[model samples]
Target: MTTLNACFRGQLGDFQLDFEFSIPSRGVTALFGPSGCGKTTLLRCIAGLNFLPEGKLEVDGEIWQNGKQFMPTHKRPIGYVFQEPGLFAHLNVKRNLTYGRRRAGIKSSNDNELHELTGLLGIDHLLERDIHALSGGEKQRVAIARALLMKPRLLLMDEPLSALDQDNKNEILPYLEQLHSHLEIPVIYVTHDRREVERLADHLLLLKEGSIIAKGEIGELLTRPDLPFGRAQDAVTVLDGQVRHYDARYGLSTLQIEGGTLEVPDQLGPTGVYKRLRIASTDVSLSHQEALNTTILNRLPAVIWKILPTDGPSLNILLRIGNMGEGSPLLASVTRKSVEQMALKEGQQVYAQIKGASLLGSSSTTQPRAHCMTPLIACE
Candidate 1:
């Protein structure tokens, strides 16, 4: 197991990066926040790229920085992927890949690792091509492959997908999923995008301006009403559901959740087990009773837990949903105007309308035990 138990505090010209949280002994721990919210600053501090005023950094049980013991950037065993793919144009793709591949041999078996990575990234055909000739997505895939070639114990990604267009993002996302599913290396992923966090984060550390606002498993954190970042456009409810059955005739998948069945888009699985789904706040509507025949498929029984009035037009409603299986409660999001108009209150029985969904995982749609685990940093 690997853990990060350290605190770093620093003040730049007009910005201050002050935050603390531990990663899991293993798995992806996402640092999520708004733009210019100290996410990248914290990342740089951990990587030894930026020195904090009073900083202490540790990874894999080893102390990398502690006031007097500041490890240089090059001395650390980390792979850094910038927001943009910073590839060297002077070198060919093969040469750039080999640059990091040589370092990986220190921890992995050489002959197979190199061949496997090339195939996984699907850049073997572009090896002979020049760097500038590649598309934004292709360049990024190469950047990721190069970083992995270093065989780092910790991978640090700073909004690696933010710079790409939608098409380019789509092109690279599958590779990220594969990376998350198969790689054993721990990753500290920094992003402002909720979708990326939902798709990849096992553990989550929520950040606000120059401080750690909250930290928890991804699904739980998103459902927290007290969170300042909770009502933004990125705010969403996370659910782990299994595909009990798929009705191909109607192009629907019967997702058996705790409270009841939810029908979502058909791309999911015969996935034998289940799929994790992300439902947006705006996608859901509130009703006094279960919804009747309409284009919407889910009309489950629910209890209103809390209502957060976000603004004049909409509200953020938190619902305590009964899981179809054994587990803790799940959360759903709805708007404020809907809450007031319906006079939704605690313990009131209501029907929730759900629209969009993003299906996750090829196997059991959730954590083996309870969601996930995270590391904690002890600070005085």
Candidate 2:
């Protein structure tokens, strides 16, 4: 598999940022960390905004920087979307969207691409409106359409939804999902929000003060007992499943996964469609044996993989869904007293109980796996 390899050593005043890593060349790669974890700085380095003389970056085969050779910001094929939609205040939405395409020397006859992008972003209706008259969500959609018109090899988004209110953010998330689904170019997204990563990212990279602490697929990273994310209080695991049965009268749908079926509330999509569901660690509970007269609707047999302690008195239990190592794992958080009461240990068989309402389903797409032999290069 092709990969994006990067190595950088720089300084922002007294803070030092030094790291080397490689991620898959396709799909969304989320850079997740706290406020001061250098997520934005690294993104700038990739965009050629914060030029690092010693930085090294290779995207799919082309080298953007190596030793003294550096590509200027304007010459690189990149599209950037910031938190605020920096649309031209004096121009209509149509003019603002076409500005980048014209500057990139694209032919004016490529109206089909423009129409498709505007329709996908749901901004075709706002093309006649002035930029100052649009709402926050509409403005952001226009910005995204403008970025896509450039036909870039790489896309960089820095918290594009952070400035909007919850309602506005919800309005724009589905369009972003659709855009991600149709694009072929790789994207590097920077955010501290775990929900966004779960919703969109194919790969997850956890950053600390200035270095990467862990990196892997979204599903594998979430259930890892040795990682900080697995020990987090709000940790969650995402599973890919297909809709098996839907009862219209009772407003319930059943999804078939690797091990068993999950019954959720009201999945409107077709029965054969693929869907992804997220379950929080706190929303799941484990039982020593299957019990009768339970309110929980979903329960699957699993084997205990490992037990990890949290910051407080809770324990994060990692349970493998099936007998194979490639099967998905489930995470459940319980108090230490419950561990003693149930005698839970590694290799013990148990049932994972989950509430129907707690399983939040979302539309998701898959990508090819990254090969384990992908080269890794480091520089000082």
Candidate 3:
């Protein structure tokens, strides 16, 4: 299996960063943590900008750095996108994009590739516009396209959206999602935003105080009761499901998940199309038996996996969604009084009534798709 292996031990000022891990060479791997946690520092290390003598880095079997040899930043096949767009103010958008290809000594065939990339990023129409006239989101899209024009084996993004306002962030997110679904290059994204992690990342590396607290698949890490994410007050579970059926009459699509089916309110796509789902703990409720008269439409049998106290008055309940507790996990937050009133306990079987869910993004789209915030209101 292709993987990127990295190990670094270094000291910068009074702070020390020591960590080692390997992730797949495709999909987005988020370097997630709070401020001053060494996310950007680690990214720079991987890019050869902050070389450490004790560090070793490999990308898909190529040794970029080792004790015996060190590859320079420009020599390594990498695309770096910083917080700022860094576009040339005097250049047109098309000229700015072609500059990278020219620097890399790419041939005239880059014209066709550039056209395709610009179209994918929704910047083909803006190719003739000057960089100075573009919006924040538009400039960032051009920056991303310019990076891709160089055809890098790995991409490093250091909080590319941190400088944008909410409107621009929202405008650029779908384009980022398109890149995540369509590109084959591995991306190391540094960010402190949980929402961005939920929507874009396939793998996660959680850092705290310059040390790795957790590293694994994003879905598993987000729902593990022992992790900080699962214990947080606004914790949520992410699930990937395929559209099995769509009812045009009621405007609902049935999504087949790991161990069950969910009736999402939107027509996600044709059958067999895949999409991501986000279910918050607060949006889920529990009952000993399925309520027949309630307005809730999503009620699935689940077995209690674990129960833990939260930082607030409520407790976090982890449930395995299946008859024998052999399926996808779900989280439900309920008060201590309700837990006592319902006699909830580990290993007990109950029903998970999902109050709502958000459709994050599509896995099959070549271009950006508008995210659906439609609440999941029914299931069968």
Clashes of each: 11, 0, 0
Candidate number with the higher lDDT (2 or 3): 3
Per-residue alpha-carbon lDDT of model 1 for 1-380, expressed as tens digits?
A: 44676687767668876677776655678899888788888888889888875788787778898876898998888889998888889998888888665554555545477668877777878888999899999999899888888877789999999999999988888778666656667788999887788877877888888888888787777777787545565467777676777777888887776667778767476654556677777777767766677777776666676676564456676776642223323344555555566777877766666766667544343333124554456545
Best by TM-score: 3
- Give lDDT per model, in order: 0.73, 0.81, 0.85
Each candidate: RMSD: 3.6, 2.6, 6.7
Q: Which ten residues in a row have the lowest lDDT in candidate 2?
A: 366-375
Query: By the TM-score metric, which is better: model 1 or model 2?
Result: 2
Pull out the clashing pairs in model 3: none
Distance from true location, Cα of 30 in model 3, Å: 0.5
Model 3 vs. true fold: TM: 0.94
The C-alpha TM-scores of every prediction are 0.84, 0.91, 0.94
Deviation in Å, model 2, residue 252 alpha carbon: 4.1
Per-residue accuracy of model 2 over 1-380 as CA lDDT, tens digit each? 55578888887566688867787656788899999998988898889888777889988778999977998889888889999999999999999999887777877675788888999888888888999999899999999888878888888999899999989988888887777767888788888988888877777778899887887778788888888878988778887667778998879889777777788888547767656688888888988777668878787888889998898889999988754423578888989999999999988888888753244324444433222323376796
Q: Which is the leading candidate under lDDT?
A: 3
Error of 2 at 140 (Å): 1.2
Q: Which stretches of candidate 2 lie over 4 Å from their true place?
A: 244-252, 292-295, 323-326, 357-375
lDDT of 2 at 174: 83
- The ten-residue window of minimal lDDT in model 3 covers 371-380
